[model samples]
Target: MRIVLWSTAIVVLVVLVGVVYEQVGRYRAARDFPAPGKMVDIGGRKIQLDCRGSGSPTVVFEAGLSVDGSLSWSAVQSKVAAHTRACSYSRAGLMWSDASDAPYSARQVAQDLHEALTRAGEHGPFVLVGQSLGGLYATSFTKYFGAEVAGLVLVDPSHPDQVARVAAFMTETRSLRSRIAVWLAWSGLLRAAAPSLLPQAPNQTARDSQAVHAFAPKSMVTQLVESDATDASLAEAGAFRNLGNRPLVVLTSMAPYTEAELRGMKITPEQGKQVQAIWEKLHEDMATWSSRSTHRLLPNAGHDIQFDDPAAVIDAVMSVVETVRADRDNGSH
Candidate 1:
């Protein structure tokens, strides 16, 4: 009985220490790294939006799942901004954005973005550049607000049917891992290990992204929420099949999964190859969504094309922007 009581007390003390550590870490992070952009109120909640440059059609960036919000576009946003108005924003519960009790779905995310842009006076004709899961959200945005969207750039985007098609990707173990990540984040263990866990890229943008992710405790929770709603989000995005004559650029990464990645997914090399084949096919199908679409395969790039090759992404965006500009000038848009 005494041993049980002592064990309980020790656990309680450890938890208290963890909570205090998290609080202190959070305070220091907030002090050191303030929001780098305007916090525009979207009704009850506020979202951080960083806009730069100036031109007719604004370029908006949508980040991937479990990323550092607007900071994910740090490498390419400024370069794109130089030619046209480019903006990146944090979704609710990520980075500097306020969290919401409401469920996180693609539609809700699209609505939040629309409200944010409108309230911030960042009007469109807009070109949306989405990376990974962000591509689905961009598709959802176009499904609802097609008129404002002039073009789209999907960088190794997630396919709507990936969960069903990629057997190695949607496993019970993967779901369990996501749940474990949330617990780690809540316990502040994730923050402690974040520096070592994230990629040790040499650039300042990478370091800043790492810092923001390490400090954001709710980021994991938000990621899990988004993961849970993946099916619904995919369905919502998949509903939009056609983009008419709107310029579209689908960049597919040809990098194969590494041996370690295959081991983690518990799939054989043959199975991994099959998965890649299906992925490429899906991108090809996505290219058919627009009459003026250009599907480019990057041999040296990976899923995070924005990071793997920012110049490729910039070129894609510029190409789409130029196409939109030409259409506008010809009064054919």
Candidate 2:
């Protein structure tokens, strides 16, 4: 009986210590890494918007799920900014942005972005570049604000049917893993493992990403919430099929899942191949959405094509931008 009581007390003490550590870490992170962009107030909440360069038809970047917010596009943003205005933002409750009590959905995210850009005095007829799940949000954005979108660049974008199609071969473990990650982040345990867990890039952006991964516990919660709403988000994105004659570029990464990755998912090599085929097919179909669309595949790049090959992303964006500009010039004449 005494041992049990002592064990309970020790557990309580450890939890208290952990909570304190997490709070302290959060405070320091806030102080050290302030929002590197404008925090545009959308009524009661503020979203971080980072814009650089100057031009018409601004290029906006949308990051993937479980990413380091705007920092996910760090490699490509500056290069694109050189040609025209390039902007990237953190979704609500990620990085330097405030949290939202509203349910997470692609529509909600799109609405938030629209409002943020408007409030920030950033006008549209914008070129949107979406990576992974961001692709879904971009599609939703076009559905709601079609007039404002000039073109789209999808970098290994997620398809609405990917979840259902892949489920036949591999069980969905990401949802469970994301939940565990949220708990780890909340308990401050994630801080210790974050450096090793996140991608190791040798640059200032990588350091900033590591800082966010270590300190932003709420971002983990946001990621989990978004994951839970995947069905609804997919449904919303699925509603939009055609982009008329708008310039579109679908960049598909053809790299196979690593042996370790396949093992972790409990998927055999054969199942992995099947899943890959489905992915490629979906991306190919996405290219057909527009009469003027290009589908490019990278043999060596992985899912995170922006990091694997920023040049590909940059070229795609530039191509779309040039197309939009030429159209505008022709119309003026």
Candidate 3:
């Protein structure tokens, strides 16, 4: 009787405490997150831009999925901004960019970005740098917004059509299983029992998300996670569903995990070969994609080439800058 009541009260108290903790964690995650930098009104939408540096053939970085604005472009933005007015922006509904009723497609994003560049008085043939999902946007710019682009550097770019051909093997095996495992690990029961600890070192000294964006390069894993550009229920399908014609540099992840990654993904060797062959074809298509497209491999790069290898990205953009300068000079004649 008395003992049962005490135990019941204790259980209720524990549940209440857990609820409070979970809410606190969520609130912190939301609050600690920083708004993107420098809002520019482009085509009636509030777009965030980090436009630093100076000079022409302005180097622009289009971020991978989920990331927008300064944080999205951190890795390569500053390095390029040092030499030219490099622009990195948050797409609509991402980070600090205005949420739109519009679908998140390559074309729509490109149009919005076009407006931003125009509003900033940025002119055509700018060097484009994009990683993962951003590759779709960059490629679309070449096909649809050719007037503004000069050349492109695709850092581990994603292709719309070949996606099914790309990760299908992994999806068929370990990836799905790992995803399920993570789901279980982060489930309500586990989260309730999990210790209250900060993701980084726990001092309650919350990291300055803004400073992280204002400074430092993006993380390779974060970049990799930004691969899905669309919010579609189907996952892989998104706007700018194809890479029509864009100068590209496809940096592949050589992290050594295979179809036997962690889940049920048991991709066959033939499947691995197929994925490689698809990339080779994408490389070959680059010639058709641009008048002068280069495919350079980053030996130790992951999906987020910019984040993992900023110097390589810097080198690529510098190369484009040189070309843009030469072309402008030649055109002036």
Scored by lDDT, the top model is: 2
lDDT per residue (tens digit) for residues 26-58 in model 1: 887778788877999988889999999999789
Query: Would you list the rank order by TM-score, best first?
Result: 2, 1, 3
Q: Which stretches of candidate 1 lie over 4 Å from their true place?
A: 168-170, 173-178, 201-206
Q: Report the C-alpha displacement of residue 140, candidate 3, in angstroms.
A: 1.4
> Per-residue lDDT tens digits of candidate 3, residues 1-333?
999999999988876776665456445544766454477787677777767878887887887664334465565677788888788887675555666667456667778888887787777667787776676677666667776677788777665555455656555332554344334332233333223311222111233333332211222123223333343312332343343343445555554334543333356666665665676576455434554667776557655566567787788778867877876798731
Return the clash pairs for model 1, or none. none
* Model 1, C-alpha of 243: deviation from truth (Å): 0.8
TM-score of each: 0.94, 0.95, 0.68
Question: 162 in model 3: Cα distance from truth in Å?
Answer: 1.5
Compared with the true structure, model 2 gives a TM-score of: 0.95
Clashes found in each candidate (C-alpha, N, C closer than 3 A): 0, 0, 13
What's the residue-level lDDT of 62 in candidate 1?
A: 96
Residue 6 of candidate 3: its Cα lDDT? 100
